[model samples]
Target chain A: MNILVLVKQVPDSEALVQVKGEGSGVEVEDRYTLNFFDSLAVEEALQIKEQTGAGTVTVLSLGGQKAIEALRTAIAMGAAEAVLLEDPAFENGDEYATAKALAAAAKGMEWDMILCGKEAFDDSSGIVGPLLAEFLGIPLVTTVVKLDFISEEQAVVVEREIEGGKEVIKAPLPVLLSAQKGLNEPRVASVMGVMKAMQTEIKKLDLAAVGLSQSEVGKAGSKEEILRYHRPPERPPVTMIQGEATEVVRQVVALLKDEAKIL
Target chain B: MAGDVWVFAEYQAGKIRKTSLEVLSKGRELAEQLGSGLGVLLLGSGVDGLAQELTAYADTVYYGDNPLLEKYNNDVYYQIIAALAEKEKPHILLAGATFLARDLFPRLAGRLKTGIAVDCLSLEMGDDGSLIARRPLFGGKVLADVVCREGRPQIALVRPNTFSLPDVQSPAQGKVLPLDVTVDTSQVKLEVLDVTRMAKERLDLTEAEIIVTGGRGMKGAENFQLLDDLADVLGATVGATRGVVDNGWRTHDDQVGKSGKTVSPKLYFAVGLSGAIHHVMGMNTSKVVVAINKDPQAPIFQYADYGVLGDLFEIVPLLTETLKKEI
Candidate 1:
């Protein structure tokens, strides 16, 4: 089996986001890292590679120069190789265009299994996995939290923390799966792995190589556009409660009844 | 062939949740504004007996009975809803942004190639009979006004606990429409192997009237037991901040933040969480919020409706005991 994992570099969850230029789109300030969820995807791919021990794990990412670092991180996590679909042209693609570009790259690779995080943290659209599956004409099982190889061609699965409970699915191989966090505890980068990751080769593909042009990438490539962005008003000041527990409960109840009016 | 607006009345354990009814009430108002009829689409394994409960708010109710759909699956429910949408051609579709709706509705939207405004805190009717929806973006940091510009049958996922469930008890007088939906069970490869809910005894966090969340101040994993006790006494769900989940004190499912679930309970008790903007974004919709922490300068205080300055360990247990006695 040839497994391909799609990874995206995003602002760290802890990093503060600023909407630059008085608009809806946001840019990370200070520092950024790989999306929290993608790390778990890379980890899941590595585990499958380890258990299978025969298939090759190739990391595929679509971004600019920053994506090389993300691909290197994936290599350090145990991917056999890394491919970066980067060009100035591919910047700022919407979910549809991004999924199209990714599907093209994935199709060329002839991967048996493709894995991605449920969504990109920055955009938070959560549409790419299923969208790419649509483009690729493959079955998709999203929000996947657990997976076991049922056969060489099929896998039994359970989905992530859904509303009421988990959904157990049996998906055939050569299908698309969007992973969720806790799918696997990501393995830490070993010193040897990190050193090798720095030396690993990153194959870069431009928009033209991926059968696209400048018009097919970035904002121009997007079907939906953000209209505006505004910070919500700050909540009102809180009333502090002091003294003994009994007195506090009395105050809380009275406050809930009188002030908030929920009681 | 024509209807006003439709709310998918989702029932669990044979009782309708407030979230669904809130959608129904909202749908009624929207339908009235459109000068059309309000309706509901009900489908489950054995939910025929509960169709009467749904008719209280809708002018008509459509129930599609399928044993395969008794358990929710993307394929089964979507086929049923998509078939209904194609036949009914309602001007609007609304469902609570509960887990069921979020999972099933989006796929249905994709199948029908329609736009969906998710997690909307409010929905309004425009003068032209279009639905104007207000939904949270960037994980509740900002609210956005959205409209489905493409045309009829705009869908919106109503945020849970944002609106009141009406108490009007008119008999279920609505007409019933049956849909013919074929279930291709083979495509639905997913199954519910086992089901476990954290707050099984207490109210679900998404449906809870009162939610008390803990953070790093709970001290350790064991310390959350206190918050659990408080939630038990209050019949509430125990929520936690990203910090608590990151610290390995609890599962990510229990975390309430931009990365976690967005909940708007009536009363929120925040214990120990410093209230980062991300965490506050999730619970800020709560009608009443109470914070407890030793640090007076914690950011959570800014959004908290009430604050208590002290160690949560000492205060929570006492509060739990006091509330227990009172109840």
Candidate 2:
């Protein structure tokens, strides 16, 4: 059995992001980390490989040099191999174009399952996984919180988080699942795993190698163009209520009805 | 196709979702501005009655009533919607950014070879006659304006509650057209075994009038009972930051943040939680924010409309008791 995991490098969740100039673009802080949800995908894939006792895990990422960091992090978590899809033409690609590039890279690969983060932190667009599944012509279940293989390499049962509840879905093997938080607690990489990750050679693939032309990847192939970027307008000032807890409570109850008027 | 603006009227259990109605209301304005007709694509089983309700906001209603589409099967819905878009060729297609639409729209976009802007906060027409979608990015630190420049039938998923519902002037003078589309069940690779409805009586965070959220400061899973008590008295929904959800104190459905659901409740309470930007992005649009924390410098206080520097364990119960007595 084999599993493929998709990883993305993003600024730490706590990092400060600012819009550059009027509406040109954004200037994210230099600090970068593995997207929080992608770590869960790597952890789940590793656990599946361990439970099956005989499966290889390959982690793939799409970005510049920083994306290699995310792949290495997945390697430190026990993935056997890593692939980085990078090229100048892949820049400015939207969710659809990104999924197309990933699908092209995964075509004909030997794998029984594919996993990805429910959404990327930077863009917050949770569209890639489903779009990738469509591009690869496979079934996909998003926001998966619990997953268990029913028949080793045949099928798996997953619990997907929905609006008001969860849906228990069963799909055949070779399906794509997007990992949500609470699936598992990802383990920190040990010294030995970190050393192994440092030594692992990351394979690089471009659009041409993935059988995609310049017109089929990146900004050229993207459906949406970013017109501008700007900061959200400042909100109204907060009114702080100071004093004893009971006093504050009484004042707030009054304010809720008198000022905000919701009560 | 280029002269019509389309909205996907999502329905369930013989009723239309509020977000779908919100989209239709916004789509009506866009259609009027562009001098085009407003059309709604209603898909489900026995949805002919619900389709009539949409006539108040749409100039034409396209009803696709079939048993196969009763439940949202991703593969089946994608095929049906994509085929409809191909045949009708609407200028823009709009849908609410619900879980079902979030999963369905991207695949539909891929199949139609179009671009989609998801969870957009605002939508407008560009000077060049393109669709402009403004959405929060980088955890709400920046708002990016996006446009589908080259795609036909530009698709957008607007966040719920972002737009107000237009008043129904009168029963719209529109025609309901029945769509004929065939779906092959064999192509579906995933099967729904069962759906377990948890928190059936609780309000959904996105649609709630008031929300009480806890964070890592709430301590343990059992401590959430305090939030529940307060929520009950206020008739509000309970939400958690990603930190609390990751700590296993709450399910993802109750999470409010960038990775979680964005809510615009009239009143929001941030108890025992530091205001992280990711968490703030989810509820910053809330009408009134009230924060209660021991730490006066908690980031949540900055975005909150009312700040109470105290222990939530003490203040929450007191507030709940007071509200229970007063209201």
Strongest candidate by DockQ:
2
Interface alpha-carbon RMSD, every candidate: 3.1, 1.8
| Every model's TM-score | 0.87, 0.94
- Candidate 2 whole-model C-alpha lDDT, 0 to 1: 0.87
Native-to-model Cα distance after best TM-score fit, residue B231 in candidate 2, in Å: 2.9
User: Which lDDT tens digits does candidate 2 get at residues B126-146?
Assistant: 877688999888777789999
DockQ of each: 0.37, 0.71
Fraction of true contacts retained by every candidate, in order, equals 0.34, 0.86
Off by over 4 Å in 1: A19-27, A66-69, A83-94, A191-225, A244-246, B1-4, B125-132, B150-153, B166-169, B191-199, B220-225, B242-252, B276-278, B321-327
CAPRI class assigned to model 1:
acceptable
Q: What is the C-alpha RMSD of each candidate to the true structure, in Å?
A: 3.4, 2.3
Top lDDT prediction, candidate number: 2
Name the DockQ score for candidate 1: 0.37
